[model samples]
Target: MYYFNPDMLMMNGSKMSFEEKISVLREQLASADAVVIGAGSGLSTAAGYTYSGDRFRKYFADFEAKYGFKDMYSGGFYPYETMEEFWGYWCRYIWINRYAPVPSDLYGRLLELVKDKDYFVLTTNVDHCFQRSGFDKMRLFYTQGDYGLFQSCSPGGASKGRTYDNEEMIRKMVLSEGYRIGDHGELIVPESAEISMRVPSDLVPVCPDDGNLMTTNLRCDETFVEDEGWHQAAERYQDFLRRHKRLRVLYLELGVGMNTPVIIKFPFWKKTEQNPNAFYACVNLGEAGCSREIADRSVCIDQGIGEVIGALGV
Candidate 1:
């Protein structure tokens, strides 16, 4: 195992020894009161939930020819003419991300490292990896929607007013035993055998009380659902911040990118700048760096999360 040392600081263009980086991280961890983990797609990528390659081919090969999308993200936005095709792709996506085991043990290692710390996670990843890896569900805020949820579409009093019973959706999808046309010729079931289970364009998911179109609880469009659960999680996140504002908090950012700087980077920069007792650490394979203002309290380790977690074996 590599050990970090104080004199291990290297120039920007120069390579940073993993041992030295680990030592620095250990020191930061030792003094941290509350650890806030900010994650992105890169964290999932490290765990082997890659958007393309064998995983994508296995689930979406059929649609690739028709839509030319190589990954699930692009596939989500693909203009499928039928709901059957759309649901077919999404069901597979949800199954793989929500039910399947990721390629690496990175999430588990992360859980182990933060198990003893007063920690909270704010992640944009929709895969539910942190919970699967044994992190406390209450301590996590999945800022984005989950793969296992389905919502209703209705113009509510909010900018995006939609609601869903995620449990019901998961149960229905899993219990349908695979997508098949019902007696009324409605697609319901897994798309493994039948790729024709398209969600109807007119299909508005209704409240059990009122007939309305159902939608996913995803934060993609204006109709994204911001239900009570979302607000509660946001409150928990705020509470965590307020409780640790004056403590030595460690803002550990992993695999975050510029796609949503406001979510991860901007907040990290602001917090570290405001709190003298705070430190910011970022670990990204290729994209790793921090502003000079927080240079003394920041460490941008240009390494894969899995490798770093392994080096920090709990």
Candidate 2:
């Protein structure tokens, strides 16, 4: 129901030097009554979880050779011939993105910046990076489904209405493909000849209830399951916003692009516009900006999130 009027957006912080914006953000963080972070793919990308380039080549070269897809994102959408092939690609995808050690301490640094404040994170990322990096789970809400969970795809399966953890199965799937687990839980590719693009038929995950295939818990379609946990997190987020409606709140948006503006971008704009005591800030490499209506109360820094966070000296 949210509408995005491009004409209302502006990179008004363009007038301020990067250093000035950083200073303002730091001061606001220290003084604001609460902070609500809206994170997207860019934040994880800043933390070295890129979907393409070296990371993609390192983990997905075999996939690229087998299929013509160049990046992880595209590979997700590829119509594989069988469930085995699909799960093979997805298991590897989940292992690297969800279980592997974070490449950088960006999330930890971000946690430090807000750990002392009353803050809640609203992220589109499914990597479980925030929890893995030690952010309070109670204060975090993963609006999109997780990479580490799977839900029954069958119409009437016993587990149809729930999500199940995929860690154990994903690890097994990756290990089956000759990828070894390092001391720190990183995936190590085995010899070239041992790599595989399909898991064994028996290794493909299935719903225990009716023996049907289980799909990722991601919100790709209406079939996406929002279990009890999801509902609770949504409730908590609503409560947080309600409590801070009239407070000196800071909407700290990080690396959120235009992919799903209604979830984070537009809501942040609308909330900031409603509260005179609220401040809105965005940290994105290329798409940093704010609604022109709230330009005076916003700061949109067009810089890498890591660089901006580093400059904050927090």
Candidate 3:
């Protein structure tokens, strides 16, 4: 099943045809003894979970009209004057990306590609798309914190370093439908209600150990929760790499961008270079290119993740 074709490899030279690229990629994936999937924000974006354009407009039209921002990323960093407004935007962001289902079966198609093979995922996406698509939970290590988990981010609350799944509480908040825009465009909520831009102070989630406000468990700080579950997943990823160090493994990187090249892109290149029996494949639209060092053993498909995954027809 080994299909390591040095001649078919293309570096920064004339690009390989998309069909040829898919063929080589299919062979590598089919023959690999183990597969390590490295995913990033782009992968989720490719799966129709983009944080901008129609998606953002649909979810945050009020915010956009008030703030003059066009996308969710800009809105996430917007200096909202109050925690209520912040949660107004953040909660919806989390709910749509985390709790709600994606528009496409990209993750399902991906699961079918590697379901029977020995595969593990190392992804920076927090959307929980992999698990939602039926991938085994034990085989995943979400390097970044999950959108569904929350922790206290206040200075004093840092010591109360407990993080827990906030899905239930968030569901309650969302289900309450406790918010609306006022005549002046100010976010309005019932004063006594526990969930809204201006709900009662007691209603919002806070640190159980202290009264610090709760925030998503994303990797923005040193205090981001690496709970017992996170550690177990990390150990499993390391073990998977160790067990297949020099075997016929494939490092399948998907839609990884430059935001964190060292995490996924650089490591995949290094691993492929170090292991002659290993093959490396990167699928990114427009941003697909391999370093000259491992170019011979790598396949760079400059096509959208969903398109290529669809082409595989698994």
Per-prediction TM-score: 0.84, 0.94, 0.87
For model 3, the local distance difference test gives 0.80
**Prediction 2 global C-alpha lDDT:** 0.87
| Model 1 C-alpha lDDT per residue in residues 196-222, reported as the tens digit of each score | 334443332355534554556678877
Better of 1 and 2 by TM-score: 2
Ranking by TM-score: 2, 3, 1
Q: List the residue pairs that clash in candidate 3.
A: none
Clashing pairs in 2: none
lDDT winner between 2 and 3, please give it: 2
Q: Which of the numbered candidates is closest to the native, going by highest lDDT?
A: 2
At residue 109, candidate 1 shows an lDDT of 87
Model 2 bad stretches (over 4 Å) = 1-14, 155-157, 191-193
In model 3, the runs with Cα more than 4 Å from the true position are 1-8, 11-15, 155-161, 178-200
lDDT of 2 by residue, 38-150 (tens): 99999999999989889898888888988878899999999999988898898888988999899999999999999999999999999999999999999989999999888
Worst 10 residues of 3 by lDDT: 1-10
Most accurate candidate by TM-score: 2
lDDT of 3 by residue, 155-208 (tens): 344435467788777665554556543453233456685543333344477777
Candidate 1 has a TM-score of: 0.84
- Go through the candidates in order and give each one's C-alpha lDDT: 0.74, 0.87, 0.80
